[model samples]
Target: MTSIGGAEMVDWNLAVATATRLVRPGPEVGRDEARAIVAELREHARSAEEHVRGYTRMFGEDADGAAAPHDTPVLVVDRPGWVRANVAGFRAVLTPLLEKMQERRSALPGGAVLGAVGGKVTGVELGMLLSFLATRVLGQYETFAPPSFDLPAGTSAGRLLLVAPNIVHVERELDVDPHDFRLWVCLHEETHRTQFTAVPWLRDHLESEIHAFLAETDVDPSTLLERLHEAGQSMTGGRASGEDGEGSAAESRSLVEVVQTPAQREILGRLTAVMSLLEGHADYVMDGVGPEVVPSVGEIREKFQQRRAKGAGRLDQALRRLLGLDAKLRQYRDGERFVRHVVDRVGMAGFNRVWTSPNTLPTKVEIAKPADWIARVHGDAGN
Candidate 1:
């Protein structure tokens, strides 16, 4: 219960508990509608799994002998439930960074006092961030552990979920066919499931990169201030040659971008390429499912794009921009275009080579330029 600046830095358990329920409550359902939604979800238990597997066969990998453990169950959840789920994911991803940060603070003169306050502030900031996201996301193919609250051995082995309330809300607001929208959302999420599970090395590849990124995130006040000052000058005037004349693009970047060291930046580049591929592949699959099967698919795409374009007010939009979430959205677009172009030229079988080994993965620049990737990959094969 130690604290700094009247805050604790590492109480994610408490932060998640407090913030999970603070999200906007979705429209209330009568008992009948509730039962219907649940029943439909339950009835189509493996609908996403089955459909995604079928679609991905066209990508050169099928469900057969796929490495993903089938024991991972898909669950349906409300907004508060989604918050609980995501906080657990954040916990797993951020734990390494948090541990390293706390250790550094504890090494200071008033290490004890600073550690508590810093942990508290960081936890609170993260909680507020999660709560805000809970109010926005419609569907997520969550793949981390369940919240610490749910484990007592063999209790909840879940890693997949649909934010049921948000789905219903968007369906209502858009006035599109409910069934079509639900299926479409499932297709997108299920694609994520297949990507991680089917490709054995992918999950660990991502985990390792995240660990590397977090390991490099040891920021001190003076260094950060200096970076901020240099970044400001870069934006207002001109990009400075790094004291090394490298003249990199680190100037005035987002939170995720500015924190990188050069080595970490290379790692980040690889990760960005991989994530773009995953997201882009998923987008490609979902769209490829086509409007013929899902009648309102076109309308949903149009309305969804409109929704993404509209800002949720100044504060929300500002937060997304600063946090690099805007870049995240760009990943989907950039990735989809990459996948589509690659498939068009080389076909799905050729693209499947990417999953054969991490070495074949595209860099960030190559994601935007498929021909470069094609030439390099084909040349390497020739060698």
Candidate 2:
């Protein structure tokens, strides 16, 4: 890690500014209606926390018996606020990668000059990426948010964000009950919050994995230049280096997939396994909540799965693929199946062992083979 002029590799402030400017406005509502929506979302989040804890058996015998030591704060935000929060998260978690990029830049002949211009260019690119995501995400538990007043009582625990407009927009699009939809969304998000807050070491373990991944980046100056050139060509309607005909498999790969080294790919596999487990666990918890809690739970899941399968418009779909979001979609399905299989084979208590420590978590191969994870973690006792 190296610093040139004591400045960051990506201009984060500019990233926020660019994203805010480009992001689409949320569905319109009256001021009072907006306030009501925000308030209800907040209430739903709190209530969902209780339901998630009870169903997942995360806290204790009684949902209230053993509360999470640091209850993460919930923030109901619009698109711009979500962008800002994610940019903060990106800056915090990506520090090592940024420093690595800076080191690469410094080794070049005109390194300082490259850093100055590259920072803003990278900022704009990041901003464009965030703008695309801001509208689509319904809720996110920002695992890497920097410590700030955003956390309750100044605790460094992460914050749960409910994107009010996205929630409203999706419910309307799906023709679902807003109340049930909102609560359903909260249930998924609250499960993530509980996973981190209740388990304690989860967040730090994830952060370490991310840092480890970034620290292994070995992109040289020439490779960086080549990637930038390829990116420029793609942006200007030119085919990428090896892109051949329409619907080529290579064309669907994201920049993330294209640039990884073998070492980075191995680390990414581990990270993917962890993320899959977390996300799958959340989906399992949400779906497992009975109809008494979310009356339209079945309808919501059905419609949402259809919507996810259909995805957005062509250009949006292309962007999603470019951003590696399509892989994220796979994680949900695969991870959920993995969780479902394990829970059926063993039980909730046996499944709980996955959260005991990092070692107990599934490997990438084991994620696809629940039997392997069970054998490794629980042995035949689970049988």
Candidate 3:
């Protein structure tokens, strides 16, 4: 890897090899196949590079003649260590749970589709596949311009970050087994990409809500400064605020945290509700698809529930902490129940009709009170 202005460029050949290996776990690409894929990827990379360059020429520099973009540079990686770490972490933590989830499919409304894909994958290869899948899903939305994954330069867009390091850290901590982890993560992230793509309005809705929340957020600089000063003093004196005087600095820090404003809270609530619905629907789809495709569907579903019960990362909690929007646990249950109810009452065809329009889709209230939703659908059908 060569560094330019603190950004490292990744070798595309290595990336393709890693990705190919992950997608087709046991066999290595033959010399001819490797050459062909690398050639194709190079062409793809060239196009991506050109796109990024054009974007830079138009929007890269600010009025001050300095690079104004805040996003990390998009570099091609042939063998990024972080990518491997992420794949490994996801496998370690998520695979066993998925296996367990497969066992309990009967109890779950839609647990039949666990481990739906049965191919072997190396960690690096998995990341490449995920990145590719994410691109496809995000491409469905007209508003979302795909990032230049092949480029070696950053863009002005800060919202969509390819924070490979952060991703690796989170995946590692989650500690799920790799194969199952990759499947779930692929489904999860791909679901997000699909939802944003399928619901064009939702992209703006989420972005606007996030901006609105961020705009209203007020951090107490004074409090932050005081805390820093106190920490410095304690470090020098070896005596903090506690009676023991040997306690850690955290002990002396204020327990109070930043509180959300009413407006922020409202936005957060709406965001969480939508996210929960999205996740729940994905879970439903997975459950539906898994049993038919994967042999271990029942075991995986059981494992997934056990992981959740053991205080494993809740989709809502992680999203809330990351975006300041909490997807309530009940929201998933409600959303899943709603989907199942809709499917049961009207069949998949009727359920699909609701997605014909955002307005037709069930509201937060409808999600909570599914009977009203059923009645509305029936009444509409009668009309």
Alpha-carbon lDDT, every model: 0.69, 0.81, 0.42
When 1 and 3 are scored with TM-score, the better candidate is 1
Which 10-residue span in candidate 2 carries the lowest summed lDDT?
227-236
Tens digit of per-residue lDDT, candidate 3, span 8-54: 12223443455444432212447675455334433432333333323
Error of 2 at 371 (Å): 1.5
What is the C-alpha RMSD, rounded to one decimal, of candidate 3? 19.4
The numbered model that scores best in lDDT is: 2
**So what's the TM-score on candidate 1?**
0.82
Ten residues in sequence with the least summed lDDT for candidate 3:
135-144
Residue ranges of candidate 2 with Cα displaced over 4 Å = 1-7, 61-70, 152-156, 221-252
Per-residue lDDT over 1-383 for candidate 2, one digit per residue giving the tens place of the 0 to 100 score: 25576555777888899889988898988999999999999998888887887788767543765655436779999999999889887777777877777776787887877777777777776777788789999999987777777564446578899999999999999999999999999999998988888787888888787788777777664455444444444544556434555564236667667658888899899989988998898898888984868889999999999999998655565566677788898899989999999999988988888989989989999999999999988887867
Sorted on TM-score, highest at the top, how do the candidates line up? 2, 1, 3
How many clashing pairs per prediction, in order? Answer: 8, 0, 39
Cα deviation of 193, candidate 2, in Å: 0.2
C-alpha TM-score for every candidate: 0.82, 0.91, 0.45
